[model samples]
Target: MVRLEKDLLGEREVPATVYYGIHTMRALENFPLTEYKVSPVLIKAIALIKKTAAEVNFELGYLTKEKGQAIAQAADEILNGQWQDQFVVDALQGGAGTSTNMNVNEVLANRAIELLGGQKGNYSLVHPLNDVNMHQSTNDVYPTALRIAAIWLLKPLSEGCAALQEALQAKEAAFAGVIKVGRTEMQDAVPIMLGQEFSAYAGAIARDRWRLHKVEERLRQAALGGTAIGTGINANKKYIFMVNDRVRQYAGIGLARAENMIDVIQNADVFVEVSGLLKALAVNLGKISHDLRLLSSGPRAGLRELRLPERQAGSSIMPGKVNPIIPEAVNQTAFHIMASDMAITMAAQSGQLELNAFMPLIAHHLLGSLKILTNAVHILDEFCVQGLTADEEHCRNLLENSQVSVTALVPHIGYDLASKVARRASEENITIRAAALALAVLPAEKLDAILDPRAMTRPGIAGTPK
Candidate 1:
């Protein structure tokens, strides 16, 4: 069935079976930029806003009890996962997210009209503009809904960081005694416990978790009541206060109206800040993943100091080969998030006065980064970190052969003597331990104590009294 709905442009045919009306139809025609729709998370958040707006309007006598009840009911159904398919506008639309807000308004207005025993598109009963979207503008509503969606996702991202931190800590404990050769600039440096490396990763994640927690405070101040340009034009001041409070109550988040509503509307610095935080997390994750892949490079020709779980075959042609698929996946996710941060940075600054038209771009990349970062943390924890093992004997062998291990005796002997021992070891093609013994740099017992894993890893000069 086809129904005609009128807009400023003229009347257009809308699919009668679907709740979305003329505005949405026009958006679909005008902005077919991508296959992606506005995130369902943002849609659900908008439903909360509309439901609260209706109840407040009814309380303030701006809407008839029946109209308000109908609108609220439609919004309730939407919040509970109804009519998701009716939100048909692409996420990449122009007009500063007006397409999204109008798409939502038209859907609820049509659904409410149906509830009131009126046919869909019969706006005379519950007009999308006059009733369902009473005193609201896309400039205010879209940004507010985006903030709420980001708030919802940030909590899980924080929790994901925490879980990953715990997994790294567990590895720290499990590998505390296993000494490995540390590398600097891709060259062997000195002895370090495998556990210490894991501990550093845990520390970085802990910082990321704290950062995610703190960034939410910036998002808590909203511009909900500041309709169009933050002047609250066409909206009752009392309704503004009431609606903002009610939305906060329904969301169960500590949201407050911005003291300078125009500032929130005009400046998108908070999202840039938040995106930067996410990028920091991505960098750390990328570094850790690359380190793991490098450490687990090969069972024969590579470092082979750490063992990652065998996932799929490394090569279709190579026989009996396994790959570090989990870390590789995490590395890609990190790269995408880093690029998203850059996109978010550009969009944030590209806005002009009064409002940012690039908000849809900001929302797309910011929300995508949050979701993928959270998933990456979880995958790294469950699939890679949990199953990781260290090749202690191989690590020990590498340390024994590495010339840098001779540096452990530098404080006891001297840098000059240490260099001589390293040079002699290289010339003779013998292990550092053998060269040290052959050179009689120190007593065997003393040299052994100096290079002990505990003495090397802990604070203090090895083979020397405190």
Candidate 2:
């Protein structure tokens, strides 16, 4: 290990292993790994983080071209793919992203140092803090990274919504002409096409996509140069624009500085708002999942208009049983996202003056919720919706068995007679069609035409023969 002098700030002495690509080791030694690591989104957000810091460092007259090229090259590699597989770090520990920010600097600097034909730990040639970090502090960098990470992570959310929309569209088209019972309070009330239910589900996902897109607009505002407080202080004026420009370029995004540093640095309500959007998305997912679970309950005893993919054995004792496991996963993810939103709200409220020290928890829970919901959406799309089946016979049987068909007799035999028919059908366990025939509520041919599920599915038709 090459020996290095202590920092001019008179902080702890630099370790040699940190200079040699041992980012994890240095992170553990310098900042406690704790339970939470950095978020993958934040890790990816480093391109913006480094771009902002590098320009500022260069403007501060501390960075040389040779070191700059090295850092830039390493950053490019990270942006491309080299470090994509290592983001499973716990997100529950560390304050101010000390461990995470330093990990990026150390790893990138080591890789850049190697590219410069210099041995690792040879700050004599390139220094992670002095050259790579320059005029930046973890305070400014962490929040900036979080914003970029949230933007990066929104991709999956968008795609998940699209997939759900497609699923609903497909189901809508497939069941367009298939009629079924529409229920209110679990009792038959009217008629609607199975396609109408799927269309509603599809419409819900489209609305969710819109909400997420709106939330992302607010999330794009980041505090890049607030630097330890609401003031840029020692940072150069042009450095902010340059870093933000480069970060946007690298991230393929439209990131911008906060309009007001005082408000941005002091308040984390934007994060809370974004978290709430995620919770809203989770609620949508839970609603759709619950609907699917209800629609696919059983082949024999329950409403079986639809069928989910049989992922695992649903019952321990029953044979050939299948359950809506994908929907269940979606349900759990929704709960987690809601809880994460609460954490974000609390953290945003916990700020004292200009900084929220509880940001670590906010980032941790929000990122976790994003990842969990992302995977859940994908799983539901791939392993469940893609494989769903419709029970044609069961749907027809339910429609035929419902007593709501007695309403067709209202205009023919009058309301009082229709009520008698419905009550008699319910009491005798006979279908409304059978009771109508026994009571001579309407001619058999007229009853058959008017009580048809397809005829009832049309609007403005009160189950009367036309």
User: Candidate 1 on 1-466: residue-level lDDT in tens?
Assistant: 7998888989998887988888889899999888988888899899899989999999999999999999999999998999999988998989999989988999999999999999988999998888878888888888888899999999999999999999999999999989878889999887799999999999999999999999999998878778899988998999888888889999988999889888988789999999999999999999999999999997899999899988778889989999889999999999999998998899989999999999999999988889999999999999899999999999888877777678788887899999999899899999777888999988889888787756777788877886
Scanning candidate 2 in windows of ten residues, the lowest lDDT window is: 2-11
Candidates' C-alpha lDDT? 0.90, 0.75
Q: What RMSD, rounded to one decimal, does every model reach?
A: 1.3, 3.6
Q: What is the lDDT of residue 312 in candidate 2?
A: 89
lDDT value, candidate 1, whole model: 0.90
Residue pairs clashing in model 1 are none
- After superposing candidate 1 on the true structure, give the runs of residues whose Cα lies further than 4 Å from its correct spot: none
Find the candidate with the highest lDDT and give its number. Answer: 1
